[model samples]
Target chain A: MNDSMSTRDSLALAELVELQDVSAVAFSGQRLKPGRGSNLQLSVAAGFALTEQALSYKFDLDGSLVDVDENDPLVQLSLSLVVTYVPRNANAENWVGGDHERLKAFGDSFAWPAAYPFVREGVTAILSRLGADAYQLPMLRPSDLL
Target chain B: MRSLYERVTATLKGARAVAAARLRHEVLALLHQAQLASRMTQSDVARELGVRRSAANQVFRGDGNIRTNTLAEYLHAMGFEADLRLVRAGEPRQAALEQRAVRPAFEDWRIRRPQPTTSGVFVTNEGDDRPVLVRWAATGRTESFRVEAEVTTLPAANSFTPLGKRMFTT
Candidate 1:
């Protein structure tokens, strides 16, 4: 993994992170996780569940009202941001290929900045940016959800 | 309120329908032009392709699944190449809208006659500006109209039976 971020790429990533922070503050009124992946999960204080994807954000506010053993809120809103990066090599083999690892690292690094804003500020900033309800919760790691 | 899943499903269905209809229309138009240029009887072409006359008719009617290879063979037999390209969004919608606008007026002027069963001349008037004669066939039909106000020289018709002979002679 080359792991070298150009000045322009670094600045763009920083801006995306800032936007995520602003969104979290505006919506959930609480910051959950500052660094997460696209599969970041949240159990908001407002009884809503939040899940992030690549294309769009989804909100499952209804899950909050249900009484269950885990009692965690359902995902109410999901915010998806478009993140694009070229793989280090085009002809990398399947899962065991070095090129595949490089590509995954590249995507993870680019996605980090956007994930930061969400985690640091929480859902309030996100909902506020979207002119929606507040989301209060801690960020759920991708591994935990899986 | 509709769920997110409903919205995405509807979008996918709408896109698929539009694509299928456009493909059908394009294939029909190409076959129609090829048949007209070839000047071979539909039955003859059907025999050559080892298909029924109704199948040939369906080719013009834009019904039936046409394998790409079969369509290519048909086009090659007619001395034409089959080419397809993606249609941009703007033009198809504009064409559809124009067709819809003209359809009602055309229908109002159309004279409904008994469906013709064989190749023959038919004349009918439903308050038309001129007298029209239509040549009817099971596969397709052609129409010609004569206006009282017009005096123009008509081109002599050429006798072209089989397409292969016509091409080599020309």
Candidate 2:
């Protein structure tokens, strides 16, 4: 990374277009079958693509809770997100094969740090609305995940 | 006190806001495509519209919200027309319909016509192969909710079908 490319600077130049599919579900007691509570699990997956203009990045994050007892379907929630990122002074015309992969790498490795807060806050807000106890999701860095 | 329905509505509105924010760029990209198609420069469009070069550039850069009339005029200058669409999730595109000046004043102009601030359209300039797609899904006890917005274009210089007219046919 160039000295000029810093997290602060990148975020300053990066413009977020949107976040979608922020949803959550909280389990109510008695809904969960005995022993089924031990199998509860959560998972996160993300994908990134360059916008048509090559001027931005669109990152999608999907998070869900699974393995809830059949009776406790309410205990699970699935979310889908669509995010657009525009990097200052980006040239999409020159982005081909290898360059495209590099850009996706950059999106996974850098853009997440900039966009995670919005995702985290959005998830927090929606879950709170559903009467779920306020929970803190683990903070993840691009290096840690990618 | 807000009911659960109201709370869900508020959260959905927030998601809509995010999608709307993204529309700024999508619109700009469409304008850029129009300019390219017409072989005009920013200066040319500005000069024709009698706006400053920076103002024109700003609109194309998605710097800020644009007025409906201003956007219409700008596209007209480029020989294109902007068609705002409110598409439902999983809806199939119907056969092209004839364009009508038939604006139901009460239902459209009075309550829901295009405005300076809210165009009520989301423009995704991606091509057919790799399209920029936005999808929202929310579940409830019995029913789920989903809707999409998109912008389509046609040549303004020629009388053509309006996208809103075609999709919004009640």
Candidate 3:
């Protein structure tokens, strides 16, 4: 993947992680589903990671938080991060196992900061330009996951 | 000697007409109070609701039968609360029947009836004989009209002769 596209996709994935965080927070306020073991999953299809990130920022502006538990059966943390990228410019048939391997490697690396506070702040800043709040994203630790 | 079927049918028809007339009067009384309190013309209300003036007039005149949701919306627009009360079926029937009977007499005596401001009308037009009497307060004019064809002629027409004279001469 091109360096610019990779950076864009990574940022987009980070934003989705942010929104899943906010939903967790709002749901937490209601105390409907409590405990840190709760998990929120976001599926990013392909070309709309930017759109999803923008949406996440919008939710943050509306005072939402995302919370997850360490012992969650699926992904664990005070947050979650998932990023999958399909080549937008390249022909699908031309791609090989090497591309998949690269994506998996990128997913692991990109997922970390994407699940953290800095990306959330960045999203908040973007949304603030549109007259919304810039909320602090909660910190997460790998040890918190089971 | 009336048949059982005829008695049942007449009772049902009477109940329906009474219900319908009561609804009409309730709606009119509400609109009348709203008009007096707010000093708002029918056109003003119509404009606010994005409806035609005639539609608003119909609402005030208690002419159109409206849906509950639409009535609710109108009530909301007018800053009124819609409350539902649960009462015994027999209680409502008795109260409604009494009100239905006494209302015309009150109007005939030129007495001011106690009417609260409300948004919607409740009507049940089941019965065959429905008598509706409307009196214009300003002109002291009284008009008695009935829904039934058999009872179309006015009852005690002479009782209103004074009111008729007062309305026509001046």
| Best prediction by TM-score | 2
Cα displacement (angstroms), candidate 2, residue A48, comes to 2.8
The sequence of per-residue lDDT tens digits that candidate 1 reaches over residues B1-170 is: 86553454368676567667777777878887998899877787788788888987777676778878778867766778885444454356556658743122122225644343222232435665322323332322345433222111111112111111000000
- What proportion of the real contacts between chains A and B does each prediction keep? 0.00, 0.02, 0.00
DockQ of each: 0.00, 0.01, 0.00
Write the residue-wise lDDT of candidate 2 on B22-129 in tens digits: 567657778899999999999999999999999998888877688888888999999999976544421211211233333322323223322222222233455643
Q: Write the candidate numbers in order of decreasing TM-score.
A: 2, 1, 3
Query: What lDDT does the true structure give each of the candidates?
Result: 0.39, 0.46, 0.37
Best by DockQ: 2
* Candidate 3 C-alpha lDDT tens digits along A1-146: 66567556545433333222211111111222333222233221111122211111111112222344343232111222222222222233433233332333234344333444543554344334433334444454442211
Q: In candidate 1, what are the lDDT values of residues A58-115, reduced to their tens digit?
A: 1111111111333333333433222222122224333122233332332334443334
Model 2, stretches more than 4 Å misplaced? A1-41, A55-74, A87-92, A95-100, B1-170
When superposed on Cα atoms, how far off is each prediction in RMSD? 34.0, 25.8, 29.8
Q: For candidate 2, what is the lDDT? A: 0.46
Pairing residues by index, what is the TM-score of model 3?
A: 0.26
lDDT of the structure predicted as candidate 3: 0.37
